[model samples]
Target: MTQHLHTQADLDRALGELTLRDPRLAPLLALTGMPALRRREPGFAGLASTICGQQLSTHAAAAIWARLSAAVTPLDAERIRRARTDRLGRLGLSAAKIRTLKAIAGEVMKGHLDLDELAGAPADEAHARLIALHGIGPWTADIYLLFCLGHGDAWPAGDLAVQEAIRIAFVLPTRPGTKETIALGDAWRPWRGAAAHLFWAYYKLAKAPGFAAAPALAPVEAGTEPATKPARNPNADRRSRPEAKPAASERLKRAKP
Candidate 1:
């Protein structure tokens, strides 16, 4: 049976098991406190929201999502499939995103992708099914599983923030790439989603101005940078990076359907 972190208690329980499984993470939990369970609506709206937030800052993504949500009545797959590309463009979606959303809507309508059922599927299987759809990548699929469906084992190995946090916490010489990150997550097993939450919390705290390094770990240098830049995504918007802030329009230009 698949585990789901659908509530705060569920996440806390997973964190407990995770800390016991990997004692190194205990210090991280101590420093970060209990990470909150952040969830989105399930199904089409949830997945669509994740798509809108891709490669954009929190404010930018939220702004566009607000526009899209307000403009589209109901915001269901049927409505999205029927909506014109131009109309969606005026709502701040890039041409590529518009195509992607429509394609997803079509898939949902055809009953080829069952978003709700994915919550019950094994993490790897769910991830595979989601990525099989047009415009859905590893990051997007894992984000949906972890945040939307609350799958306990869904690990977002491609997330730059998680990669950086792991590098810092493990005191690695360099940030791990996606494949390396995925391999590193093997030990975490079913609690990888909880680990992702912990790492994201750690990343935020570590990135705060004048934040002192934890005594349990090596001192993080002031203004320290990741050892490598994130690899660019040609098919979709790159995930948000701490060092780079390209205009959303520029990112859209690079995104292909």
Candidate 2:
């Protein structure tokens, strides 16, 4: 197994090796050249932000948080805990999200969720604990580990942005789902999260040269998930999303026996 690649130098070396292995990855190599890996404090606030960002666009998430921070004067557990549901809702949170925030705050305040212990726990253990909460899911936990905790080997397999970026880069016939992205990204290994960041950055850069970005999605509630979608580009996009409009998750649903 690969040990966690710590430090910016390790990421730099791995990216360099991959690009050299395949000249095709030149753009990725350029965009992510020795990027400063963001390291953040792992705690209730970080995890909560991860949950808030799920399925929402970056602009939308940021806006909501700005509003939320202002709404709750102190912006801590007690403030969120005592907040009325309507108050949170007014800040652009959905009914589901209100419960999620409340649960997280409650758990932390009640001493059920331990931010310090979680920081040191194994990835799997941390993931499991997060999922036990009311609204935390795999994608949310994965992102927390990847960006907030700065876990070297974390991957948000279900992130839409990763799928879309991979599609655009490789120019495939269809959009790659979580499972598909995971398989294709297997070669990236321990540096996959950084790979994800590079792909996201590339998505932004790719849209710069008159390539239309994906349609503007409606503003999501304050704390929501967002998956990024990239428009087709020949130099990139090894695969394509099966349908023109990415299939809606619930719309693709089935009954459980």
Candidate 3:
């Protein structure tokens, strides 16, 4: 977790390998394409973004963040720490999220977390530190690692979309909770974060059936042709398979967003 940034190829290779093995997850692995590990500098902005994004729709999180950013001159750690709840709320945040944001800001202010240290910390250590805060949890921590820290292996099963995506795509009769999801995601190791990214991309595809459901492909490998596969059977605990569960790689989660 010491933040060994993953290159686009690193992510692509990991995703491609996972896609080929898991028929249910293949399309998603294909759709998201690949992104070079994006490093959002750690500390106030990073923490704030993680909290604000929790459980909110991607569009909703973006809207709120835009407002928050506009409301503050230099929306950095100090500013967020001093800003009043009303100010942040007006910018677009629920009461809970505002509190969560403040808690994170307070930690930053108190020096409980050194932004520099987090940037350098590996995935688990960084996650352990983040969750020490009032509201940070596996889901939130996972998101931060995946997006902010750019920890290649970070994965969050708590994410509803991930759970939902897994449920529908894999045809899982039941949705996996944190423990179960963690257990299930084990095989995606070293690229679990990429898998999460893939799922989001896959969700975009599965939203609509047929053409609308199809995700924009990134050109299949040479000699490959497009074909559909059956959804994953979430009910079938793939846990027993040769693949082990992913280490749940400490990270963050979003409730519904």
Candidate 4:
């Protein structure tokens, strides 16, 4: 069965289980404490919002999302499909983002992609499906799985913060590359998503001015591809922040079963 970190309790349970699976994480957890559950609206709107945040700062992303949402009525696939490119551009979306959004909307309407169905799918499967889309990259796919769908097994191996955190915690000579990061995450297994949350929190603390450093260990060289792909948006270095809330009219309503 797949695990979902939909609430604080779910995250706590996963973290506990993860600590048991790998005792090294115990100290990291002790340093950082429990992380908060960060969730977004699920379905097409959620995916679109993720796209909007790509390659942009949290404040910039939130501002653009707010303007876009206020301008687009209902803020769904149908609206996106019917919206003009120039209008979307005027709402602060770049041409590339506009194209990506339109492509995703078209897929959703054509039944080629089912955003909601991916929620119950395994993290890897869901990730593969998402990355297969025109402009969605590994980071976007993993983020959607972990944050939007709350898939507990989603491993964001390409995240720079996670890689840096791992280097600091494990006392590596350098930040591990994407492939090395994936290999290291194998130990965490089904709780890798929780580990991701833990590491993100730890990253913040570890970078703090007076935080105690991890004990020195044998240096391991992680020579492989860079932590993130060149195609991915580069603005993910900052800690994840909440996106702007959509207007009441743009909020997603529960779909009928």
Candidate 5:
């Protein structure tokens, strides 16, 4: 298999390649610097954490994960499988998430899913296996490949942060859907995962101190093209009121089973 980005040097190489591939990203890269590679070891516990984090904001996910981690103490597949439903439920996990979490843990414990070997598998092969599991969707599978497996080219087209960041950076009149996002991501091959990290960093930096919240660009409707003009809200003044909107996690909740 080709080398995955398992080190800082690997990530640097990917970013450098990205800059050469598309100099348009140079300005955004300069603003954001090298994006941080948020790597996670391949294991049942880390995957379980991803399950728990579904549909929740980063802050909220971290909080719930903290509680679950503390409760389980040594959160392993067996531990999670054996944990009482009431206890897990008390940790603020929704009923659906709890069931999904247990199912994933059970599958791993039963040797039905070997995460280590899976990590080494090709991205398409790995994604096929992951999405076959209950409650795990494309978004979850892509995240697993991108962060857990460190797959160099993994890109989560379904991610709203990525869509929003692209809207802001490209100055698109609207956010691109999965098809559009994938097409746009074609500009950055092999380093698409790094591109994802850069977009997340850009999302934060764009909303950094003194910078206005990036305009809430609407997604272009199906079968129709996006308007050339930026979306306008005549009722509220753009300067005074930062159009009150749902938090990213809230507005962009995962499609949980």
Candidate 6:
């Protein structure tokens, strides 16, 4: 059976479990409180939104989706598949994105890619199936699992915000790569989805007023000069090297002479 995170209770449980597994999350929890449960209706609309959101800013995605939704008139798989590319472009979808959207719509219409079936499937299996389709990657699949199907343990380790949050939280010298993020996320298993939410929450809060300087985890970068430079000696450039102090043996020799 597919377990979905529907209530704040689910989020609370996940947060508690995640805290127990990774104490580092405690600081973020204190700073950001419980993360918002970003749930989405599980179906074509959700998948279509994910497709529309690829590489687009939040406002841009919302605008494009709004236009497309209005133009599609009911916005079903068949309509999307039959819609002209130029029409979709006029709705603000790039040609590449239009192709991907149409492909997704066609698959769904043909019953080859059923979002409902995916909703009940294991996260890994569902994720694999999603990525097997054109224009879908690990990040997209993980987003669908977390937000759409509400897979409790879905972790989008490749997400840039999550990586940055991990870097700041862990005090790493640099942002964790996808592999490193995945390894780090493994400790929050069974609640990785919530962990992902927490990271995103922290990412947002850390950028807000008063929290900008909260990331004191890592040391300053290497090769950074001190805040104040030493005063320069104008004659130092022409001055000869200072004489070295004589050793005990040399002093004795000079005394004997």
Best by lDDT: 1
Q: Give the TM-score of candidate 3.
A: 0.69
Regions more than 4 Å wrong, model 4: 216-257
Alpha-carbon lDDT, every model: 0.79, 0.61, 0.63, 0.77, 0.71, 0.72
TM-score: which is higher, 2 or 3? 3
Clash count, one per candidate: 0, 28, 29, 0, 0, 0
TM-score of 6: 0.80
**What are the runs in model 6 whose C-alpha is more than 4 Å off?**
1-3, 212-257
C-alpha positional error of residue 232 in candidate 2 after TM-score superposition, expressed in Å:
33
Quote the lDDT for 254 in model 1. 27
RMSD of 5: 11.9
Write candidate 5's Cα lDDT for 1-257 as tens digits.
43378887888888787766565565677778887778875687778788878888989999999899898968888998899999899999999988888998899888998988876765556766888899998788888888888887677878999988876765564676765676555556656788898889888887777865322222222122222212232331232222334332222222111
Kindly list the per-residue Cα lDDT of model 4 for residues 1-257, writing each as its tens digit. 56799999999999898766556677788878899988998888889999999989999999999999999978999999999999999989999999999999999999999988988876767777788899998898888889999988888888999998977776665677776676566566677799999999989998889986745211122222222222222332222211323321111111111
Which residue window of length 10 is worst by lDDT in model 2? 215-224
Q: Candidate 2, 79: how far from true, in Å?
A: 3.1
Which residue segments of model 2 deviate by more than 4 Å? 1-14, 17-27, 31-41, 122-125, 210-257
Candidate 3 lDDT by residue in tens digits, 67-128: 88788867786787788988787888988887887776677788777766765655555666
The 10 consecutive residues of candidate 3 with the worst lDDT sum are 248-257
Q: Which candidate model has the greater lDDT, 1 or 3?
A: 1
Off by over 4 Å in 1: 218-257
- Give each model a TM-score: 0.83, 0.67, 0.69, 0.83, 0.78, 0.80
lDDT of 6 by residue, 130-198 (tens): 888889878888898899888887778789999888666655556766766765554566577898999
Give the local distance difference test score of model 5. 0.71
> Candidate 4: global Cα-lDDT?
0.77
Model 6 root mean square deviation, Cα atoms: 18.6
